[model samples]
Target: MEDLMQKATEATDDLYRIRDTYFPKDVNHKINTLQTHSQIALNILDSIPLEERKLATQRATYEYLRGKILDVFEEYSKKAEDHLSKAVKLNPSLADAWLCLGNCIWKKGDLPATRNCFTLALSKGPNKRILSQLSMLERRMAQGAENQEEIVAESIKHAKEAIALDVKDGNSWYNLGNACLTCFFVTGAWDHSKLQQSLKAYQNAEKDEGMKMNPDLYFNCATVNTYLENYERALSGFEAAALIDPCLNATEEVKKMINLVDKLDGLLKGQIKAKRLASLTSSLTEVQVKPSYKRATIDNLLDGLNKAIAVVGKVLFFIKHENITPLYYLVCDSNQICFVLTVYGMSNEAIKEGDQVTLLDPCFRNNNFSWNEKHYELRSIRVDFLEQVQVNGKPIPPRHSVRSSIYAQHKP
Candidate 1:
C-alpha cells in the first residue's frame, strides 16, 4: 500500500517536470504513466477501509492527477471529471484537482460548471495556466452572447489578466491574439490595430520551439496576413500549415490565392481585359447607379434567410467566386460576418479592397462554423451602395477562409 502511494506521488511529480512543454506526445507519455499508477492506487484504495482518512486522502491525490491526465482525450473525460471531483471533495486544498476537474467538465460542454471549478481552484491557489484557460473559455462565451459588448469586455478583462500573470506562457499569448481579433471584428475597429497586435502575439507564441508543431497557430498567422493583404506571406504560412495537417486542403487554397494574385497582376499589366479592372475598382457614386433593396444588419437578417435583405458592413478581404456565370465575392466584414456577394460585370467594378459596401437583396446561407475556426455567412450581393473610405488611417483587405469542408465541395 505504501509502495502504491509512493509510486502514485512520483508519477504526478514526473508530470510537472515537463509540464511546460507543448509536445502532445511527450505530455501523453507522462499522462499514460500517471494513469497506470493511479489505477493501481485506486484499486488498492477500494479494498482499504473508508474510515482510514489519511490513507484515503493520499490515494485520492492519485485519483485527482489521473483525472487530469485523462482529460487529454475526449473518451476518458467523464472518468476524469468524476475522479477529480471526488479528489477535490476529499481535500478542498487540492487546487490542482479542482483545475483538472474544470478541464474535464469543460470538455463535456458544461461551461458554467467549468468556470465554477476554475474559480474554486483559484481560491485555493493561483496558477497561470489555469487562469489562461479560464480566460479563453470566457472569451468564447462572450462571443455567443447577444449583449456582446458587455460579455466581450469581461472576456478581454480576463485575457489581459492571464497575460499579465505570465509573460512567457505561449497559450496565454495565443489566447490574447484570439481575443484581440474578436474585438476587432465585434467593434469594427477602423484602423485594424488589433489585427497587428494579434499578429505580434502569435509571433511571440511561436518563439516557443514546441509551438512550431501547432497547425492552428500557422493557420491563424496566415489568416492575419490575408487581412493585411500580405499575399506572399499568407501563401507561405498556408503552405507551412498544410505540411503539418494535410486534411486542411491548404494546398488547394494556395492555388486559388495564386490565381487571385495572377489575375490582379494580369489586370495591372493590361494582359487581362480592361473589363476586369472595373470589377477590381468600381463604386456606386462614380457612375449612375440606383438601389432597389432595403438595408439591414447581419444580426437582423438571420431570421429571413434567402430573402433580399441588404446588409452593410466594412470590407476586410475579398475572394473571387469561380466559374459561375455572374462573378461572386466572398467577403469578410469588420463586424464579424462574412458573406458571398455576387457582382454583375459593371457592378463588379465598384467592389474594391477596404470598401464599406451594402449588399442589396443579399441571400444569407450557412457556413460550417466549427467553434474555433474562421467562417463566413454565404450571401449573394446586389451592389446597391459602396463607400470606399479609410478608417482611422489604417485599413487592410478584409479576411476570408476558404479551406473549409464546404469550400472543398465547391472546388473553385
Candidate 2:
C-alpha cells in the first residue's frame, strides 16, 4: 500500500504538468505526454477509496484531467458525444464542454436541440463565437417557417446583432443576404432599392473565399439578376451554380427562360412584317378626285365615299384591337372612287384588293366634324358613309376638291 501511494502521487504531479501544457496553448509533445499521464491518473483514482480521497484536491485534479482528455480526442472519428458527455459529468460547469456538446448535436442534424444547447453555453458564458453559430441555426429555422415576413424580420435582427459582435464574420453576412432574399420571396415584389441592399450584403459574403464554395450564394445572385431583367447575366450565374450543385432548381429555370426568349423573338419578327404592309397600303391612296357632275351624281359619289370610309374604319378597328392607339390615315384615289386605309402599327392582315370600305372624319363628333387645330386634317373629310367597292388593278383617282354635301344638306 505504501509503494502504491508513492506511484499515485507521482502520477498526479505528472497530470498537473500535462494539464498546464495542453491548455491555452497546445504543443504536440506536451499533448502526447499528457495523454499518458491521464491514463495513469484515471487508474490511480479508480484504486483510491472515494471517502478517503481528499475531496477538494481530487475535484480540482479531476476537472483538469477531464479538460485535457477531451482536448486530446476533440476531433477523433468516433462517438464524440459519449466522450464529451463524460467530461460534462466530471465537471458540469465546464463552458467549453457545453460548446463541444452543442457542436456534436449540430453534426447529428438535430438543429433545434443543438440551438438549445448553444443557448445554454452562451448563458454560462456569452462567447461571441458560440453566439454567432446559434444565430446561424436560428436563421435557418426561420427560413422553414410559414410566416416568412415575421421570420425574416427576426432573422435580420439576429444577423445584425451577430455582425455587431463580430464585424468580420462571413456567416453573419450570409445570413443577412438570406434574410433579404426571404423578404423578397414573401413580398413578391422586386423592389430595386431593397434588392440593391441585398446585393451589398451578398458581396460582403462573397469576399470570403469559403462562401464561394456554397452554391446558395451563386443561386441568389442569379435570382437578383433575373429580377433586374439582366437575362444574360442571370443565365451565366445559374450555369456556374449548377456546376457546383446540378440538382438546383435554378438550372431548370434558366433553361426554360432561354426557350421563352426564342419564341418571343419569332413572334416579334412576324408583327414587324404585318406593320410594314399596313403602312404601305395607306400610302398608296393619296390623290382624291371630284367629278364635275349633276347634284345627284355628286350626292351619289359623296355617299359612296362615306360608306367606304366606314367599312374600312371598322376593319382597321378590328386589326388594332389590342393596340394602344387607334388612329389611321386614309388616302383616296384621284377619281374619289377608290381608297386605301393606313394603320400606324403592325396588322395581322395586309390591305388586299376586293375589300369593301368606308370614310369618316377622324375627329367627327355627334355625326359632325370638329374644327380642332390638333386634328384639323382628320376633321376635313365631310362624307361619312359605307360603300361596297371592289379592289382591282386601277390607278387611284386624281386629286380634286369635293365640297361637304352632308353639311350643306344639314344647314337649316
Candidate 3:
C-alpha cells in the first residue's frame, strides 16, 4: 500500500509538470497520458483491501490522489469534487487535498469557494505553492471589476508572500512578474515604474534553471519590454517564446513589431521630399501652452515622468492597428524629426493627418534596433489623457473620450 501511494504521488507531480510546459500540439496526447496515469492510480487505490484502508489517514491519502488525477481534466468533474471533499473530511490535516479541491472548484467558476479552500490549505501551514495559486486567483478576479486596482494590488501582495517563502523558486517569481504586469495594465499603461518592476521580476525568474522550459515567461517578459520600447529585447524574447511554443501568439507579435518598424522607416525615408519638407518645417509659429506648461522638444525627452510641457508637431499620417488603445500616428516636429505618436483616452477621429497637434506631457522613448541585418531607429511618444493632446489648437471634445479596449484586429 505504501509503494502504491508513492507511485500515485509521483504520477500526480509528473502530470502537473507536463501540464505546465507542454505546447498546444500535445493536448490530445497529454489528455490520453493523464487518463492513463489516473487509471493507474485508481487501480492501485481499488486494489488495496477495504480492511487495510480502514484507517482515516490511509483512506484520505487514497481519496486525495484519485481526486488530484480527476482534477487534471480541463472540465470540472463532480467525481473529483466528491473524492476531494471526502479526503478533507476524513483527515482535515491533508493540506494538499484542500489545495487540489481549490483548483477543482476554480474550474467550476466558484471563485469565492476556491478562495476559501486555499485559505483553509494555508491555515494548515505556510505553503508557497498555495500562495502562488491564491495570487493568480486574485488577478483573475480583478478582470473587469470596478475595484480592479485594489484586487490587483492584493494579487501582487500575495505573489510577494509566495516569493518570500522560497526566494529561489522560479514559479513564484514568475507569478509575481505576472501580477505586476497585470497591475501595469490595470492602472493605465502609463506607469513605467510598474513595467520596470515586472521586467526585473521576470529576470529573476529566469535565473532558475527549471524555468527554461516555460515559454510564457519569455512571452510576458517580452511584452513588458515592448511597452518600455526595448524593441531589440522584445523581438528576441518573442522569438525565444515562439521557438518553444509555435502555437502561441509570440510569433505574430514579432511579425507585427518588424512590420511596424518597416512602416516607420518607409514613412521617414520614402515620402519626405526636400521641397515638401521645407514647406512643412516653415509652418511653425510661436505657440501658447497651458498656464503651467513648459515647452520642450523631442531631443530633450526623458523615459519616465517629464515636466509639464508641450511639443508641437504636424500629423504626417495615421498608423492604424485594430482596436488597440492609444491610436498610433506618425508626426514630425518643426525640425523635420519624425516620431510615432500614440494618443489614448480618445477616439481615432479626434486627430487626423495634416493636423497640427500639441503633445502635452508626452511619454517618450528612443527605440533603436536591428532585425534580420536591417537597422531601424524610431523616436516614440505617448499621451495617456485626451487633455494632453490639442488638435488645431483646441482641446478634444469630451464626446471623443472612450474607455480603452482591445477587441479585434482590422484595417482602417
lDDT of 1 by residue, 333-390 (tens): 3334445553422233345666656554554433222212422223333331123212
RMSD of 2: 24.3
In angstroms, how far off is 167's CA in candidate 1? 1.3
Local distance difference test values of all predictions, in order:
0.56, 0.48, 0.82
Q: State which candidate has the highest TM-score.
A: 3
Writing each residue's lDDT as its tens digit, candidate 3 over 1-412 gives 7876787788788777776677655568878877787777677667777887889999999899888888888899999999999999999989999999999999999999999999999999999999999999998887768887799899999999999999999989999999888876776555668879999999999999999989999999998887776879999999999988887888899988888778877775666786786687566556667788877777877975576877888888998753365578988887777888977556778899989898888878776678899988777887777778888889989887654142112100
Give the worst 10-residue stretch by lDDT in candidate 2. Answer: 403-412
Angstrom error at residue 69, model 1: 2.8
Cα RMSD, model 1 = 12.6
Tell me how far the alpha carbon of residue 248 in candidate 2 is from the true structure, in angstroms, after superposition.
5.0
> If scored against the real structure, what TM-score would every candidate get?
0.59, 0.42, 0.89
* lDDT for residue 1 in candidate 1, whole number 0-100: 52
Any runs in candidate 2 off by more than 4 Å, and if so which?
Answer: 1-112, 124-132, 143-147, 188-192, 244-253, 263-412
Candidate 3, residue 214: CA error in Å? Answer: 1.3
For model 1, the stretches where C-alpha displacement exceeds 4 angstroms are 1-53, 188-191, 247-253, 267-412
Q: What ranking emerges by TM-score with the best candidate at the front? A: 3, 1, 2
Judged by lDDT, which candidate is best?
Answer: 3
Ranking by lDDT: 3, 1, 2
